[model samples]
Target: MDTQHDIALTRALAEVPGPLPVSGVIHVAVPHASRFTVVGNHLAQHAELSLTAIGIGVYIQSLPAGSQVGIKALAARFAEGETTIAAALRELETHDYLHRTRERLANGRMVTRTVFCNQPGALLRGGAVAPVTVASVPRPVVTPVVPAPVVAPEPTPVPEEGPPPVRLPSRIAPKPPRRPLPQPREPTPELHRAASALLADLRRHAPELVLSEGDVEELVPGAAAWLERGAHPDAVRHALTTELPQPPKYPAKIVRHRLTVLLPPPLPGAQELTAAPRTPVTPFQTCEGCDRAFRSPAPGHCRDCRAQYWEAA
Candidate 1:
């Protein structure tokens, strides 16, 4: 029974075909029945374009008319970052595969219009190629204009002249004046140092508040104004960092705004306020009379030793 089973297995193995060694890419073509996009070899096999650029070109070509193909949109759709996608888009534009035009609408709003060309080479060579349909939208037909026949001009008759027409100046509307920016006040050395330290420490509380050296210098005076106005360091910090925009785009701008808008009122008669009373402390002294440790104003003697000395004297 074992010999018969081994012979059957050997016969089955011989009947099966061996696996073929793959040296390169093997394509299995499947005919499309429904949704499909036809891409030309010129764009798919572009030598100058990077893989990312080629993929982006194919994607834009597959999109329907009036589709959003902006960098942010593409970045959201694909795993590529905005910078990489933006670079890819620039490559496509350079190769004439994509055209982007900024047009002002009838309502005075500006918008970007994008057009994709399937055969950019033919267009570059000045050859008329049929418009490539993207998705479902069809391209508009352009009509050629024929030149009108030229006619001879007739002689003009002289007319009685009246006063020259009054010339009117074109009406132009004056623009509105812009608001002036807040200026930083000159601060004392102590105030400046305190403000600088506070501004530098902001990043510890909120990483988004990281500031450059120039930014710290420029904003120091404003921060010093807050300190000079009797505002506590913690109060100023809270005002600058609390409820910060999800991620502060401009840390310096936010700092400047808080310093100006949330400035505390200066204390009235601040100089007249008396300092807090301190606890009385006795000085440590060694009594010469008794050679003992005591707490007294001077190192003369202890109370007990002083009484004894007076009596003995």
Candidate 2:
């Protein structure tokens, strides 16, 4: 091909996504002749015993030696009377060991190119600045590894069998005295509640016992978790002592379950309070105990008065 045609083919080859199959090139070069080489995706075609075969054989041989085959010119030369390039290509396709590709020109023309070897091989045409090579597919190359040497363990010295013997060595003195134990920390309110709950259990289940508040406090450390859950101490101790389906001795689970059981439906926000007050308060007749006035407080007395009145009544 001419230099202009060659440059055009180079640009076309570069435009291809990767190496072209020779078939791809042929498809691109269907109506136009171009000078190009294949980089990837081989062609499959048959070439009978003809000038085309000879030229292809020659072209294959000339590749590593660096020769350019103006593919269109070569096809014209080989595709003489009654013999078609397609037929020749069909024959060439019988060979399993060849790699081929097709490239397209700017005008959407194709040139089918081929190589004798498999992929990652190159095809160099004359006057081209760079040779076309298929990108290599990675393959793992396994190498045998030598194992490290085994180390022999040192033998432990064994004492000979004998009777018991005397003691020795007064040089090392005993360790110095440790400081006195730390003062105990006070139990938190939650711990106190939990302890009381457990003590309540003892009061019920183990009715014969009389444990002082201090004794209960001491035992609190062990059962304070139950008390914190608002459980009575006696019930907690009975459950623990009796191995009744006692809860897991963890405050988190206990409190969580307690809240889950005791939780009421959520109250509506102020936005939902659409009703007006039904019972308005009066200024006089305040309860003596609470001093808050109310209109006809329960039993005709205010909260404090009612408390005293209820106590007396």
Candidate 3:
């Protein structure tokens, strides 16, 4: 619709052969132009400065010392959304209003540190201005422009309406990451000694329940498992060392089966475990070659004896 102001604007913009003189003054504060903090109005509200960016900046600056807030919290506080906030924050980062830095705490945890700036295009490191950082200003991230609805005088031909088409992304499920394969374990002499010692301890209580080398190896793990579950060694000895049934033909087999089937449960509490006087155990296995005691087993030889035997071999 044609209006008086529209007609005047049209006439003013029209190209003519001869020039019609027109001039105007834009009043600006000289003090604002001179001061570092007092930015020129156009500079203050540059194309990069969205309403969301300005609001985010204000919110950051207004936060109290030792206070921390997250992007989701900010979205909830402003009654906006995560996507909108993220886009605004991206804009802020590109324009150098802020940059996110990864910081490590004394406790060895990683945290994201947002450094805010009243002025754009400044170098920073974890909320502190870094004078050492050379200035190389980054370009701003462009926000998407949405076209306005066009109203027409006459009705246009509309396409036949149907249900919206299903997207490819919505149907497919993402696959989980594959795990790495397990590595084989190596055996040590102390592990062997432990199995032999456990069988030796069991023989002290029940002489008939004899275990072969292979049986000792298998039963050692079960005893170790019971110990790990907080059962006392004495309790395990009592539980497995039961009365012989008649002549006890296969006592060893019966004992091994009982040990396997009836593994001890974890100790109920600290007091139950501490009720009996518990002594710190220091394992001593004598070297067969040297007739000398050693803290750890070394194929029936002390470290010195073993080294000598290997060198001699």
> Best TM-score goes to which candidate?
1
Q: Is candidate 2 or candidate 3 better by lDDT?
A: 3
- Candidate 1, pairs of clashing residues: none
RMSD of each: 21.4, 29.7, 29.1
The weakest ten consecutive residues by lDDT in model 2 span: 145-154
* Regions more than 4 Å wrong, model 3: 1-44, 122-313
lDDT of 2 by residue, 1-313 (tens): 6999999877776775656776633334322122333323343232334557544643553344223333444565554533465555445545432334675656555644444442212323222224343333345433222111111122223468798887887889899764331121455875667555555455355334445666555555545444444455445554544432343344333323332333233346777878876887644565546667776635356666767778998
Tens digits of per-residue lDDT, candidate 3, 123-162, equal 2343333232222334442322211111112222345779
List the candidate numbers ranked by TM-score, top first. 1, 3, 2
Total backbone collisions, model 3: 0
- lDDT, residue 313, candidate 1: 100
Each candidate structure's TM-score, on Cα atoms with residue i matched to residue i, is 0.36, 0.17, 0.27
Question: Which scores greater on TM-score, model 1 or model 2?
Answer: 1
lDDT of 1 by residue, 1-313 (tens): 9999989776765555565336764333434533466678888999999999999988876766556788877899999999999999999989998777776667555667676776788778886755433233244333322111111122223357899989998788788664332333555788889989999999999899999999999888778877877789998899999999987789888888778777777677855687778989998898887888888877798889889988999
Against the correct fold, how does model 2 do in TM-score?
A: 0.17
Q: Any runs in candidate 2 off by more than 4 Å, and if so which?
A: 1-55, 63-71, 103-113, 118-313
Output the worst ten-in-a-row residue range by lDDT, candidate 3: 146-155
